[model samples]
Target chain A: MGIIKLCGMAGLIITGWLVGFKKSADLRFRVQRLKKLYEETEELLHRLQYEGLERDRLLLSSFSDFCLVWNGKILFNESGLTAEDAVILKEMIQKLGTGNLETEEKRLLYVLERLRQQESAAQKIAVTNGKIYQTLGTCAGIMICIFLL
Target chain B: MKEDALDAVLPFVHQSIGRVFLFLPEETKREVCELRLRRNLPVCLTLPQGIRYLFKDGTIDDRPREGVLICTAEQLEETFFLLCKRSVYAHAEELREGYLSLPNGCRAGVCGRVAPDGMVRDITSLNLRIARAVEGCADSVVSAEDGGGILIAGPPSSGKTTVLRDTVRQLSKNKRVVVIDSRGEISGGTERPLSLGVNTDVLLIRNKAKGTEMALRTMFPQTIALDETGTAEELKGVEESFHAGVQIVTTAHIGEKRELLERKITRHLLASGAISTVALLSGKIGEPPEIFSPEEL
Candidate 1:
């Protein structure tokens, strides 16, 4: 019975830590994806600068595809963003669609910097709090085991 | 091309506008020369026949005020943004001229407030002048025997650039032609070169005078072409190139050779034997371009 209780405790603690780490990894992936999208926009602007705007709209439409893919179900509400994060993301996309490259670049750099900060924060929370959660889960299981005994 | 003509602005405007444009009978899209938009005004299309308003039901009216939808600020902003590729800084130099030459050979003439510093600060209206390239329009000019050079004369929107472009393409088949594209209108866009025949080079330079000198000095082109030459500087450049034994083809905003002769620099150019032929063109909508030589005049 003691062995059974120990195994249960180990499972709960490990699951808690793994879940936390997975959430952080997901956030990091979103940040990387967003940064790549930003680079695509930068290249579009660079082309627009030297080559000129095409009337067929091929370039802008291509960018729209990226936007659609980004907003697709896979990314929807999965970045673990808080309310503040959602607002920022919405504002950034709105500005990106506006077509002002200089402003877009500045805002993108700021966004990237912010995302990096958020990623670090998420990672810190994932690692530090994950350990805390694991420890708490183990303690709870131990206490329950004691009670059972 | 007609189907995707408004690609740059499609993302920003409502679907209603796109539907109206897309639903435009294929015949009408080909006939229309411009898509005019103004703040708080109905979208007006400049057809070969005349100016008309577009309705949401895919019908057009000559009334001009019967628009079902208005041109919104968002649409205009997006158009401007996309036109400049969202890089306002890089386009600042060209924006001061009150017009943007897009890649599809369309010219968007903008009207708006001007800052004291001379940059076009705010835009109120945009007239997208659509270009229709009639492939064989320059046949007469190309087949002419004169090796001296040809000057094309026409009023504004009289398709001078179209004729010049075709002429260059045809002449470039054999001659080493160099087109000094002051505006992207001639070559379509810098990145995507239009098919300017087999042996031709296009130099994208906004200043006509500077472009002429640049072409003469470096290109060693058998023929040099410039568009809309009325200034003294352009005349001098053309004269110098002509004297250097490089044939010059160019255009001017004039109704006839008499008007061109009345001009100070052109009179001198003609007298000096630099310009051999003055080809006057008057092309009506849906009609073949009628070219008249000096003898016809």
Candidate 2:
């Protein structure tokens, strides 16, 4: 009976650990997607400035996995962005093709700066909170198991 | 082309305004020459007969005070952005040129504050000119194998471009025809390429002069057709093509036959011997054009 109970407790602890790890992984993946978005936006700016490619050509050619472009607008999917981050990104994209080269370059530079800061902040959160969540889940499970005993 | 002419421009307006277009009667839609949107004013459609204000219910009014559909400032701004295809930077050249040559050969004339760099800002109004392909419209004035050049003359909105489009389409059937469609009005756009002809080669360069020169050198076209040949530079290109023995078919804006000599470009155009036949369109849309030799003017 004791062995069976211990095995059940072990399973609970493992489940808790997996749940915590998944959350942390999601946060990490969000950061990676943000980085990708930043790179794609930079490429877009470069093409607009030098190549003068049209909107249809540019949107059709965008290869980002995080963005879904339809009917001349970009929709972010599973972007792991905060409300504020998403709003900022959207504002920049809404005006993406609506300015001259110099204006667009300036606008993109400002957005890139903001994205870099967000990425940095997200990295810091993932480092600190990720470990905390995993430890908390394991500690909570162990305490419950001890109490049951 | 008439059935879808207005439909082609619907995507470029705000959703509310575009929806109104959807409910518009088919007969009215077919005759709509221009769709005008102004800030804080009733949306208007310029038909063949006269300008009519549009309402939200898809009905139109001859009076502005009626419960007409109003084009708000925000709507105009959004419409302008859409017309630019959400990429103002990409359309900077066209915006600077004061118009946008849209898909399906539709054209939008933009009016707004001018930035020093020539880009328009804070757009206040837009005139969306619907493009229609009137097949056989040019049949009366032109033949595919006609020897010398033909120049179409008309007032604004007098179907000069329409006739020229058909002329090119007709000529391309038998001749090695190249259209210097700098504005994309003649051959429509890439999204839905207008049927110029199976043999027509369309060059979308903005500079008619450069486009003509390049077409002459590389395309080896038997006939080169262009629109809005209003400048000496374009005339020079037409003259060059003439010297190469490549026929030049083009258009010019002239209110009357006498004005052909009054305008310096038209005078040079007629005297250059580059153009032999001139087709003068009545200000009316579908009326047959008056064909004349250069001597008649």
Candidate 3:
């Protein structure tokens, strides 16, 4: 009975650790997603500046790995984006092909700058909050085990 | 061909507008020549008979009435972007020229404020011109014996491009033809382009002079065909090709023969001895064009 109890305690602690690790990983994943989005946006700007590809072809070629779904206006399935980030992206897309070269480049640069800020903020949170969540999850499991013992 | 035109244009409009058009009666859809969308104005369809206002339910009337579909600024903007395939920067040249050439030979005439940088901004309206191909339309124009240049003249919407397309298609079958499709209208577009012929080469260059030069140097074309050649630069290109002994088939936006002298380009074109036959089309669509020799003008 004691062995089974110890095993249960160990199992609970591991499940807690796994949950905390998943949360920490999610924060890191969000940051990675933002970085990927930034790289994609940079490529998009380059194509717009030099390639002059049409909208549909441009998106198809540029965002093949972006996991995006464009329905004429809004872009859906933009994973790992916050509501604020989504709004910003939506605005960028709305004005995507509506301006001249200079204007378009300026707009994209502006959006990229904003996204960079968002990414930096996300990175900071991932560093601080990520560790906090993991520590809290592990401590909670230990406290429960101690109370049971 | 009417169905083809609709197919070309319908995809570039707003979803709501496209839905309305899809439900339109076949007869109404067939007669459509141009789809006009103006900011805050009732949607208008230019039919062969006359202009007609569109209702929300896909019905049409001579005058704007209640429930008539109003083309909001958003719709106009969306249509503009869609027509440009969502990349205005890619079509910057065409946008500056106040038009966008769509697939299937259709064209969107854009009206907008011009920025100091020569870019069009604050778009207010879009005129979507439907492209239709009438087979054998150029049969009378393309003569087997005549190896000389031919010039087609007509007013807007008088089927000048249609006839020119047929001329290119028919000529290309027998001879090495190059189409200086500056606007992408002649050969539909670079992607999913319309059939010109087996021996046809398309140059999507905006500058006719440059296109003609490149064609002469590389393509070794027997004939060079272009549409809506009015600019002095285009005239210069034609002159060069004429001197090179390459036949030219092109079109001008002149309604009547009298306008030929009024326009400096037409005057120079007629006197240059480059164009042999001038086919004048009446304002009516599908009417037989009146053909005359350059001397007859």
Q: Pick the candidate with the highest TM-score.
A: 2
lDDT of 2 at B223: 94
Q: Candidate 3 lDDT, tens digit per residue, B56-109?
A: 999999999999999999888888877877777887887778898888888989
Could you list the chain B TM-scores for each candidate? 0.90, 0.97, 0.95
Global local distance difference test of model 2? 0.85
TM-score of chain A of each: 0.54, 0.88, 0.90
In candidate 1, list every pair of residues with a backbone clash: A99-B86, A101-B86
Flag regions of model 1 displaced more than 4 Å.
Answer: A1-6, A9-83, A97-131, B1-14, B65-69, B82-90, B116-121, B190-193, B230-232, B255-257, B268-272, B283-297
C-alpha lDDT (0 to 100) for residue A28 of candidate 3? 91
- List the RMSD of every prediction in angstroms: 5.3, 2.6, 2.6
CA shift at A128, candidate 3, in angstroms?
3.1
Q: Quick one: ranking by TM-score, best first?
A: 2, 3, 1
At residue B32, candidate 1 shows an lDDT of 74
**Per-residue lDDT of candidate 2, residues B217-248 (tens digit):** 99999999999998889999999999999998
In model 1, what lDDT does residue B92 have?
59
Candidate 1, residues A34-103, lDDT tens digits: the string is 5544565555555544554441242454345343433211122324455555565556555543433355
Q: Over the stretch A28-91, how does candidate 2's per-residue lDDT look in tens digits? A: 8778877887787778777767787766566556535546677666666646777877787678
Tens-digit lDDT string for candidate 3 (A73-111): 444556777788778777887677777788888999999
Error of 3 at A8 (Å): 3.4
